[model samples]
Structures are given as structure tokens and as C-alpha cells.
Target: MDSMGKYIRGYVRIRLESPAPERFFSLCVHNRIPLRNLTQEGSCYEMELSARDFLRLGRFRRKTNARIHILRKNGLPFFLHRAQKRKAFFLGILLGLVLLAICSFRIWDIQIAGNRYYTTPVLLETLSEWEISCGMAKRNVDCQKLMQKIRQTFPGIVWVSARLEGTCLIIDIKENDEIPQETPVKEDTRSCWDLTAPWDGTVVSIITRAGMPLVKPGDLCKKGDILVSGAVAILDNDSQIQRYEYVRSDADIVIETRFPYYDEFSRTITVKSYPGEQKTYPFFTLFGTDISWYHTPKNTSEIYRTERQLTLTPSFYLPVTVGEIITIPYEKKSYCYTPEEALELSQKHLQNFLKNLVSENAVILSRYIQIKLTANRCRSQGYITIQIPGSDKSAVTPKEFPDLSAETTE
Candidate 1:
């Protein structure tokens, strides 16, 4: 027992030795081979040779041509020559431990911002519906799908994002305020509500404060009808006086409008292959890092490669974006339009525009084309009277009126 630690352990394979079985056993036992473990396969003797006695045994057996290998000092596997297998296992374990520690300490608390209408509980519930929860793997979450779900549930939400920081989820949201939904009302006595016009006609309803109905249903009222009830009451010992107040008035007024339609009008309708205008991506760089993506033009003009690239860092992004870059050689192709083609294109464009306007509640009784031409640029002017069905209940009214009776000196 030479402390087996002081000596290196190795093996030798003696092949084609005559009287194989007896000779091999005799040599192994006499040489005092580290035969603590041994295996035999046909004529092969797998023996462990200690470093200290290996050289001496080699000299004693001159007939045997042996192979000697110096095992590297670092941990090596039992059967592998010059193998870093042990080191590999150790490194893998280390990495796995490190990852586990990180996961254990990661942020699991989520914070939400820019949420006024929706309480934290409500938003958290919505996120939970999307399978986005605290302690979940960040990379495993489908952000786009969650965003879509939020949009579906809350159509008033303009934008939303969810990210994991450590073990905490940071949810950011922006609400669309263009179409004013009902906001939380405060108990302010001075706050007043907006009063809009009712119908399109002459103003026959007038009331300063809350008291009585100033105009009836068929009272020839127009837009901006204020019917009896915005005046505040104050009681004195001898008299009662009207004061500032909040009021709303609904009125029905008759309106007379005219529209003229003509078969001829100057028209060069642009057949837009896309809707609206394409946005451009913003570009910025700082300290050799991109603060923003390079601004590029969207190739909406071309029929191919209209892709979108989202910015992942330096969050300021342009509303516009350019399409993908492409190289294509082509000559200009133009076509001439006949009168019928021009007229048809113009009619379609006008019809679509009118449809959109009507969808927004604009009344177009009739339209007339005073002039007609065929060019890229055309001017259109018409007289239109819109009849709004709501009345202005606001107590505040504009006092400025045009001086229609003044004579012009020029």
C-alpha cells in the first residue's frame, strides 16, 4: 500500500503473446500489477500498473512492448486518455447552480404604470387570463398574444407592454383619450358639462340658468339651444335672483339644406394600394450604440416587401416606418386614362370620401360640380349645412356676433 496516491495508475495490453493465458497471469502476479480490478477479453489482459513499479516491471519483461501514457494532472475519467470529462461535468454543475440561484432570486413582483381607469386588481386579472403571471419564465410568455387580448378586452387601451425584470413583471399601458369615454367625476361644484347644438336651424331657445323650459319640441330651435335651466337661485330677504349655473337643453329644429350633383368634374383619382400614409422609422445613435433604429421609408409604393420592424431598445420610435430595403431595376410605366375612366375614378373617390363623412354623422343633402377638368390637381368647393341632433346645454355662450349691418368703405 504505497499510498496508491503517490503513484499514477495506468494499464498495458499484451497482444499475440505465446502461451497467452498462463504467461499473462504469471507476468501480472509477478509484476505486482495494481490488479485491484481486472477484466479479460480473449487474449487481452486489462491490468492497472502503478507509476512507481511500472518502470521496473517494464525492464524485467523485455519481450513485452508496452504503451505508456502520462495522464494529465487535472481530473481525468477512468477509461479516457487525456480527457477533461470530469472538468466538463463540474463546469456544467456550476452553471446549473448559478442559473438556479438566479431564478430563485429573480423578481416575482409585478408593477403596473399608466393605468388610471383600470385598477391594479383588474389589470392583474386581465394579465392572468393571458397566462402571464408572476414567477413565470419571461421568455416563455407570448407578448403579442397578450397585447392582442388586452386590446380585445379593453378597446380603449391604445398600447400595452409586459416585461420581466428579475422576478418582477413591469406592465406599461397607454389609454386612448381621443374619444372621451366617461372619466372619473370629481365632486366639484364649479365644474360644468359641455352643451352642444341640437338641430340645424335658428336659435329659438334661450335660458340663462336652471328654472324652466325655454323652448318646446317644435319651437323653431336651432343648434345651440338652451332651454330654461342653467340659472342658479339665490334667496334674499326681499327678492330671489338668478346666478351662474350648469344646464343642458335638448331641442328639435327644422333645417333647410341644398346639394347639387353633376355628371362632369375634374378628377385624377389616385388608386391607393394602401390605406392612409406610411410612417417613417426614426434613427438615432449614441456612444456607438443605437438609440433608435435607422429611419427608413416604407415601400408602400411598390407591390412587395412591405414589412415592419419593431424597436426593442431606446424606446422612442417614430410613428412612421420604412419598408424593407430592396434592389430592383425597372423602367417607368405609364398609362393614359380616357374620359370615362377619369370620371369613374373621380366618382369612386368622391363616393368613398362621402361615405366616410356620412359615417361620422355629417349630412350631405346634395352636391353640384360647378367646373370640370382632367388633371392631377383639382379644386372642389360646395355649400353644406349640417344638422346636429344634440342641443348645447352649456351655460357659457359666445357673445361675439358679426356686424352684418355695417357698410364697407373700401
Candidate 2:
């Protein structure tokens, strides 16, 4: 409270020269006038007092026969009195305060939450159409109405809420959990599928869930061969076969397979060699339009790289972007590699090929690599044996199954 009073009422340093300066100080204390940093400088007493108290000190000075002189004036009231004489400075200050007040009521940022399948751009576009975008007045937004509109526009969103947080608008959304019913085959359909071998391999393990296993462990199978049957035979009262019902087959089948890869590398190749000559082009972008500040190269063979820098306010709001394009000229040059270099290149190519061939579920059982060197080239052959999961589903063709009743009657 004392600090605030000093700021509002201002304070002054005064030097008192009198025969009885101590009497003046004692009178100030008795009248409850605050004084700070009181000191005596050889017949002259110096102290600080509030501007209001300084005005009331006239009577005390006459009674104590003291001469008081203000050495300095400080605080907001004194500053404002000095500023009143400068018209332009005072106008600038007033305009700045008005601008700040206007910015406080305007929205400068919009944020989204709980969105996955929908993109932020799409949601922002929707909000823009609804007049809820950045720079709009917060008082104009109706949160409940906007939430309803969002839920209606995006049917996948089950719930939505909009609220204002300071100068930003926050939108939260929730999506529906139910799966869409547009699949080609429904889970509850009478038509069934069978699990078949996707490649030629030996079955190492089989786990059946809803169908009879057609291939057991250690059985060799070919591509398109059914590992589990979708049809189950029902038994009759007399222990004879009755009828068959189709069901979806579910199972896991692991198989052992061998994959062979071969790669070759040449001893001679063409490479691009860059010259020292280069050119740069700088530009600025406002909104989405680019304004170039320098000339760009027209050569078709020029290699270039672009670097962009976006200009943003202290709050991280982007309003403009700057970029530079650096172009370097190059020429094609023919280079020949040594035998050792050719061998390394061939091995690197084979390693990349093997990485692509291997899958996450594959377990490497054995691997072998053979390198051959000719006069101008090196060749690498890789053989890898692995155990991988091999379960797949293929649609059963109707023609593959004949009418059993007709065959029995014939």
C-alpha cells in the first residue's frame, strides 16, 4: 500500500536549511507525514517525502524557521505532468493503449483437440465458414450452436464442444467407435473362407480355431493349397454322414521357406561432379503468394536446394515466410572403381535386397553369400532359409466344387 501511494502521489527529495532542522522533522512525525532516508549534512537536513505531504510542510517550515528546497521529483504523477507538454508522445501512448484494448477482445489463435481421422485444416476451414476463425471477436461466437453444427457436419464425430480460452478458441471432438457397415463380406454372412498356403513351403506348426486342419505339422504344401477347410461334416443318428455346413476358417500356420537373391555391380559408373560456380535467389511470401527478390536461373541442368524461414510473432503466429534457393552447376564425369570397391558395392546391394526380403515374423534359420569377380564386374548371390507365418485367405471358386448330390445319383 505504501508503494502504491508513492507511485500515485509521487515523491520528492528536499534539503532543509534552518537553525532548528530537527524541530521540522519532529513536527512531521507528530503530524503522521511519512519521511524516508533522513540524514543531516552539516547544518542541512535531507529527506524524501510524498508530494501531498510536501504541500502540507509550508506551515512546519514557518514554525521551525527552515528553508526547504525540492532536489528531485519522481513517480507516476510527476512523469505524467512532464509528458503533458509533449503532444505527439502523449498521442502515441493513448493510441497504443487503445490498440491493446482492441487486441484483447479479438481472437488470435485457434486450437483443436481429440481429432484423429479428421485433419486440422478441414476443421479450421469449417470454423472459418462459420465465422469462428482467428481475428474474429470472441463475443460474436455462440459455442453451443457451433458444437451442434460441427456434430451435424461430421457424422463420424459423436460429440463436440467449443470454448474460448483467453484469446484462443479451443475445439474438442470425439469420434464414433462403431465400425461402418460397408465391407464387401460381413462377419455374420453364411459364405465362408478357408485359410490357404500363400507360398510353397513345409508346414512347421498349425493352430485351428473354427475349422478342421487339412495339413498337419511337417506336411509339405504348395501355394493355393487349403491349410484349413471351411466345410464341416455333420454325423447322423445311425453314425453315417448327414450334411455339411460352411464356416469361416480361422487359424495360424507357420512355414519354413527358402529365398534366393542375386545382385551384380559394375566396375565403371557415371557420376556428377560439381563446379565452383553457383547462384542464389531469395524471396518472400505473404499469405501463399511468392514474391522473388532476385533473378532465378533458367538452365535445365542446374541442381538446387531450397531453404525456407517463416516469420512469426512472439506468440508463434506466422504471418510471412522468407526463403532462398541455391543452385549449383555440375557436369557428368565417368569414373572407374577398383576391384575392392566393386566388391564392397556388390555386398551393399545384396544386404539391402535381403533386408527388403525379410519380414518381422520371419526367423532366419541359415544364410549364405557367395561373391564372384570377373574382369569388369562383381556378382553376389545370397541364399537365405527362414521360418515365417504363412496363413492367407483365397476366395473359393464355385467351379472348383462340383454338386455332390448329382454325382451320387449318377
- Top candidate on lDDT is 2
lDDT per model, in order?
Answer: 0.50, 0.78
What would the per-residue lDDT of candidate 2 be over residues 1-410, giving only the tens digit for each residue? 97887788899999999988778878988999988998889888899998888999999989988899999999999998898789898899899678666666767678898998899999999888877777688799889988999988999999898887766678889988888787676533256778898878899999889876888999999988999888766766856556666678888889987777677777778998876577787877654578875655565346454645342333333424577767776778888888778877877786676676564578778888888888777787877888888678855332233344565542
- Best candidate, TM-score: 2
**Superposed Cα deviation of residue 410, candidate 1 (Å):** 58
Candidate 1 lDDT by residue in tens digits, 44-122: 5444544444556554344455433433232122345544557797688889678556554433456789988888899
Identify the runs in model 1 with alpha carbons over 4 angstroms from their true place: 1-21, 29-60, 63-373, 378-388, 392-410
Error of 1 at 136 (Å): 29
Q: For model 1, give the 10-residue run with minimal summed lDDT.
A: 310-319
Cα deviation in Å at residue 49, candidate 1?
7.5
lDDT of candidate 2?
0.78
